[model samples]
Target chain A: MLSESETMSRFFESWRRSIFDPDIPFRRKALDVFRHQVSHVPIYARFCDTLGIDLSAESDDDNTTGSDDDNTTGSDIDNTTGSDIDPTTGSGINPPSGPKKNPAISQYSDAAIPLMPIQVFRDLLIRPDYLTIPEAVFRSSGTSGSRQSTHEIADLTLYEESCLRGFGRFYDPEQFAVRAWLPGYSDNPNSSLVAMIDTLIRHDRSGLSRFLPLDQPMHESDFDDIREQNKRIMLFGAAFGLMDLVDSGAPALPSGSVVVETGGMKTRRREIPKQELHHRLAEGFAIPRDAVHSEYGMAEMCSQAWNNGSGWFACPPWLKITIRDPQYPMELLSPGKEGLIGVADLANVHSLSFILTQDRGVMRQDGTFQVLGRWDHAELRGCNFLMES
Target chain B: MMQSDGQITRICKAVDAWLGNESGLLEQARERTISDGLFTLHDVGHMLEQVARTVTCEAITAWVEKSRDSYAVQNSGRKDSAVYDKNVLCLHAGNLPMIGLQDIIATLLSGARYHGKLSARDPWLLDGLLRLLQKQLPENVITWSTNLDDFEELRADRILFAGSEASVEPVTSRLWELRAAGKAARFLNRTARFSIAWLSGKDVEELRNKTSGAESPGLLNDLVEAVMRYEGRGCRSVAVVVAPCELSDVAGTLIPALQDYVKKYPFLHSIKPEKSYWASYLETMDRDFFESGPIILTGDTDLMGKEDVVCWISGDAMTVQQIFEKAGPKVQSIYTVENPLPLYTEALSRAQKPPIDWKPDGVDVLRWLSG
Candidate 1:
């Protein structure tokens, strides 16, 4: 039997391998979510029917064969390697050839797994049985006057494992002390910053942990404490919140202190230019501007995508990110073309990973990505709006 | 703060005047609201808060105290008077500061008998408000029950009765029979002939402003259209407008506005024609009188001065009024918007006062109906 560290490392390697290995786990998870939607979610089933895809036809046989009994399943279907062979074809399931394949496959099956609408997603969360997989649930402090949206978290153990494995690939854990400047809430049960700190304590061997005093009505004295402590900090918070601390005359930190912030600042307080925000944070913390990182994740998905100290965010091996044309949902844009960002997280076994996010982003050749805010208008295709509506 | 007996008397007189006349008028003003089964203890509380705020009371809690005192004194001689306890009375005041007192008063005046001393500290106030409001406006309130028993109860009411020609005949048969027998009854019916109207798309922002009183700009049009669609009512069934007008040109302009409204609310197609027709007929009559200039159609034009027919505009939207002039032994309630129309803010403040015998115009209608 492997040691704890060995077991952890193996999980990390498997996750990394899954990213490059056609994102099979993610696809399978997507199929599972889709199956659940068609069978249990009445609204989703009706929507699918309207789209000409008979969800009822998606049988248990299709799960194994990756083919519907009718030609309706489409041609670009890639069969799993381990699946039993079909008696008629005599060969392993291959991509359908030529014209018959192009229209049928293109029309029927999505090249990537489809995302449930926002309305359906919201409804699913309200279900008592939803996210019954014993995962931690986090709720966004809803836009003023709006209902809050609940985000189901993967098991803390799974999250810790994923975070360590993903962050370990690029940084040495032992060398850096994790210091966070997350805003503390007295009443909120599901604060992302609090969760981050909890995860850090579980993994970090460094006894040092500093929470930056950046609460509302913040004073310069809060930063003074951080500066006096004289330790490397991994500042984590919303972009705007951190910037406010810097603006309020918070002193800079040591050179090695790294800043990592998650989520977007679009609908929150006033948003500053990304470079300007970084510059102010760097000036206040006395660290390199590149040290500031931004991470992205949605309430529905389990895993997170992190920006690697640089402006670009990198997905883990088990996660696949696709940037598709905003106007055309089917057309996957090449690198450099800006469009909607779609993520397939293999770790999302309980929910859907094939989420068509409202965010606008660009895909780079290196597979790293940069987000450019949310879509100006609601996209017509996805189920995300349905959940919101 | 009083310097003389005269000042005290004047203040009392003003309060008395409001209690004796304005209160009754305001009640009458809300006749439709009450009859619609939409107003609840929370709504009454909201109105009381409005009234208390208007009176510039130091705090709503004080008003609630005064109202409870008044109620106690008024009912002291009665053997079977309802008790008013602060803990027992559920206050439905929102987060707005200085409105709690008025809400309590409104509750008392609305005939919600209370027991025990009135206290605003009760934690159940919010929950009670929500529950009562849901009960009052079940259609508007979306309910989700996690409890299996509650879910089953809700499921019984969840039968989706689809509309079709085949289904309409049987559904209306019972109602027709009751109508033929001269028995009063309410029946649910469906029809498809509705058109939504709006002043303009730009009016949406103005409509969202809480302080703005302009009949919610396009909202009046939407409401009219919704009512029309409720039973296949056409344009004539509901005449939603930015301004009440009599000119043919102004009436014609409303047609084009319907296009924009339809784009936003497609459900407008479901309005019934008869409802729209009635709404339009009423609107046309209003326009005919107001077209020459702003005019109050209620009462005789010669007897009342121009000021009497006050056209109180809230953020540029016209208020709707139903008028009755004939004195009769009529069972139906007569409703009218009062002169010097009460601002929403002011009305909410006054509602916090102690329960009084004063009847607003709308309440007069209720009294008339009950009699």
Candidate 2:
């Protein structure tokens, strides 16, 4: 048995190895993380116990053992209390509190990757005990007097590895002078999006890459200075902040400038469709609609999927997005069909790696996907990105 | 044309008969709402049932008697009574389905011309019901419009605005402008507000046992009745459930119970609230609320305004009261198993349907309307 520190260190090493190891399939790496979490993470272990998953059968062959024949999460059970009881169907998957199945391991399956619904992070910060104190805690931006979700960074370096490496795959920070117009994030020190942008700016060393003052109105002089530099520019902004620039008659950008929006419009602006918002943004920035890009991510997951000209997002090797039926959260839907999005980010080794997001999207056969805002009842307003995008 | 008390009672009787008739006005209205995707058939049936209960001859007679007995109306010779008999405009753009019925009925009972503006969300539901009343009574008794600006053109004595705080702000300013210009118009505004239920640990335990388990069918139905009263869209709907117990314990039982309720009612699963609403739901979840079937929030209570999401906070009696007090009048109702809060709190048992005599935001609109 390994000490808590050793266990966490081993998990980190496995995560680091997966970042470069091309031979290890996504499924194998995911199962390895699942085994580590089941042994070390208390909450996850309890959840597995609820699902009747045996941790001892951690080998790849046993993944198919606990696959519930029923698609439902086994939520339907009615021990009636009142006289007025309507007929209720009980087809849900029940929590396996009965005798354990001590049989041999079965076939491998992708469903074995236990998903921590994103809302769980809001209830409790699921992190390893090795680091009681987090290096940084990224909080989601919310309306006034509302609760903000926090992600404790046990290893800030690991987060940087994911954010920077993943960002590099889409846009080169060295070639572009990064200009961020994230109002809520720029003002808030506890924003992961801001922190990621900060990392990009710090590494640039060009001095031109920095946060733009979003509190004040954008002046033409600010763009004039950027245009004079004549370097390839990458402008990152929250939806509302970008809308402000657009509404204020944003100055035309220099050639090769890319505008990437993350967080949707905050309560400040009205919600427009993605196509309309992109068209308006493209018009405001004087760039082609294809040049106006988007970043699909949240504070709950360490890895991010970037949208390169197309509305569809492409994940890196370590990250994957699975579309699940909104009605039946556990059942994965076929590609091209819209449903709730489930993210399996391997980089989130310290925290729960697989997360079922409220975000609604569709996955294509080409491995690219499109986030169609949040599922029903859950708000999908603003930029659809609840975090500092 | 002015209506007598006997005439109004006759009209109410006709309206009631129309509501109960097969494929009648009420049925048509319910169908319209269901077809428009504004509410599930069960929810529309529930709200319509409430409207039917409230629009009874007995309730209207009681309101009439109460108004006649009041000093304002008795002293018609007094200068204040001169404000009666004005064209009252009803701006019915509220989130609550069939909430416009209240203002329309109030206008009729007060013996005033009713000019109503139906919200797009409600569409033809209100108009269809009103047309039924129009068939029996004078056509000039009630008038409705889709355009809010139509209210400005019609000369009026009063304007009754119904909607969210944000929705009412523009209308209030516009009405105030009219008032400033010496238009003899008084405003009766009833904006959207959230309600909650405070369950004690003992109450929760008893319920857990009575239902045979935590996820009891009856207990799940009770919770469903509270949250899904109006698809969790109405302000009067219970947006949060507070318990004076170990939060984790409450979450343990409450999560599965709500899940069962949601699973049974699949139509509710199809709803995707506005983006702004989803953001707010996420905020509540982040704070201490866990999202199961309904968003279960446990911990200290923050202000709540979102429609679809329900919050669950755990605290002792004093702590729960403090949270309730912070909610202020924004809390329309606090459904408690018993009166556990200190005196002066408006805590009551859960109502299966809407109450005939209820003051939203605790403001006596009946007194204002009757006078």
Candidate 3:
């Protein structure tokens, strides 16, 4: 048995290697991490057990919900919502009110791997008791007046590495002066996005990189001067915050400067379509619509996916995106099919690696995905006050 | 100035008169609500019909008759009728457009000195109606205040608040404060709640016949019409679908049905994309959650506590019963398709047929309001 520090160090090492190994099979790494987490993370382990996926057993437990083998024969059909077959169970009547028996998976597929509901992190720290105490805790913004999700990191160094490498892989940091107008996250030191941006700023090595203060308006002249200096700039702001800057008569930035928008308008303003928002930002910044980037991330995962003006986002090498049929969690949707997003971030080794998100998106053949909006049933959590422009 | 029954009849007649006129205050109210994006013009028309039916002389007469027979207050009130004239401060929730109109009418019929604080979200519709009522009734009979503090300042013997669950505590505490200060009051607090619909196979089949076609999963159309009314923002809206055990496969049929219906009838007051994104973000983090079009299906039976609006829950009869037990006071209405109404009688304040009135949760306002 290894000490907690040693176990975490091993995960970090695996992540570092995986980032450089794109050719590595997704499932092989995912399954390896899944099996490891089942033994270490209590919440995740219980979830797998409930789903009847026992890693330690001679074979993966095949306890499936509803009657997949013979949908007509599974549970007694009773009339509640008028004889409509329950989507999940072939026959309804609550499956005999006892523990769900393990149903055999005909084939060993990635879908068979049990997923931890993403909400567990919002209400519980995914930290196992045997694991080392977390050195830092990152929280989602609670601007919506609901409780926010918090990610406890046993190893801050691993997170720093993940953020820098994941970002550096997509866009070169040294060439750009990272100018972020992320007031909501920046104000809260525990914010993961703020910490990630801080890393980007530090990596820029230039004094030009900094989070702009909300109260103090940066004159257009100052921004223009930075462009004149021949420095590439990445301007990041919350969607609504960026809207405010433009609405306040802020002139277009120098060409080639990247404007990345993260958090949505929330309740600060009436919700606008992403196309309209991007167009407005592009028109205001004098940049191509594609020049306006979107960052898809949350406190629940260790990795962030980036969309460079294309409506679709692509995850980094260590992170994988899986679109699953919302009604059937075990069923994976093909490319171009809209479904719920399931993320398997190898960098999330310290916590639960498999996270099923509430975002609705369509995966393309090339693996890039476009987020449609929210799954209507997803609960709105916390205040997004800081995102208001 | 008039007998309670006569005063109620006059107010009902005034509303009917306004509604009948092509260019009356009711029309103006309807148009304003449409323009405000609170409800679509079609749905507003639907809401007006419910309002019209609720205040009819027939409905009022039957209600008064029932209350006189059932309420102890009525039997004893003739000797000590002073309580009948007590002031009732009405705090109307604006979540559902014109949701306060029923209560406003009820308060007036109770012969209480009705002072209402209308929801800011929907100030125009009810205000227009009230102003029309003032034209026929004396000023002493009914009135509305501009602000909560002003409503609070006026003399009141009873308090009636209809709002979100979160408002319950603060309102109660404020009333407590008022009582501590020597201004005591009796109260009825109606908080946020959602409704459920239970269907049998026969019900699904009939729904199919009435909508689209025989094999097209007509229950989906029925649910969409019920839940998506007012964009699923109102308490009367059917938020949860409780189905029979054999119909577990209904989830699959309903998901696609929802997608098609939403595309056909776009939400008038749709949720903002940003908030939707945040909600999705929060949901993706949870394992027990799943989505099917506008309907979210969850294995977590206790979703009522979370106020999960617009979702379907699958369970056996016993599981659903347990859920109802757990959901207890939060559940407002449970509509059963083929099952007997008595099956859910205990679970709800009143188990009625399909088209339910937009009443406050946990209370039968008309029953208590009529004397």
Top candidate by DockQ? 2
Of models 2 and 3, which has the larger TM-score? 2
lDDT of 2 by residue, A225-307 (tens): 55677668788988888888898788788778889988566356676667788899999999999998888877777778999
Per-residue C-alpha lDDT of model 3 across residues A1-389, encoded as one tens digit per residue? 55545544554554456534565445445544565566567777666554545334422222322232343222221222222222223232132223334432222454556555676777787885445568788887766565788888766777778788878877877667888886566667788888788877777666778878777886766566467668877888889889988898766788787889885666378767778889999998888898999888878877889997777899886788888766454557999776788888877766888887867778999989877665533122100001000
The better-scoring model by DockQ among 1 and 2 is 2
The local lDDT score (0 to 100) that residue A119 gets in candidate 1 is 29
Error of 3 at B309 (Å): 10
The second chain of candidate 2 has a TM-score of 0.81
* Top-TM-score candidate index: 2
TM-score of each: 0.42, 0.57, 0.50
What value does the lDDT take at residue A151 in candidate 3? 87
lDDT of 2 by residue, B1-371 (tens): 22367766766766676677534766777677777776677666666677777778777777656655664555667545423456777766534444466667767766666677677656666766667667666644656767655555566777776543333444655655544212656776664366667777767785555432334555445655666555565656677676665556656666666566566555453454422223333342444545555444434332244434565666666765665677555566667766556634444334345555465556545467655
As for candidate 2, its interface RMSD to one decimal place is 11.9
| lDDT, residue B120, model 3 | 64
Clashes of each: 89, 17, 50
Off by over 4 Å in 3: A1-11, A18-20, A58-107, A378-389, B1-352, B355-371
CA lDDT, candidate 3, residue A177: 81
Model 3 chain B worst lDDT window (10 residues): B347-356
Model 2 error, position A256 (Å): 4.0
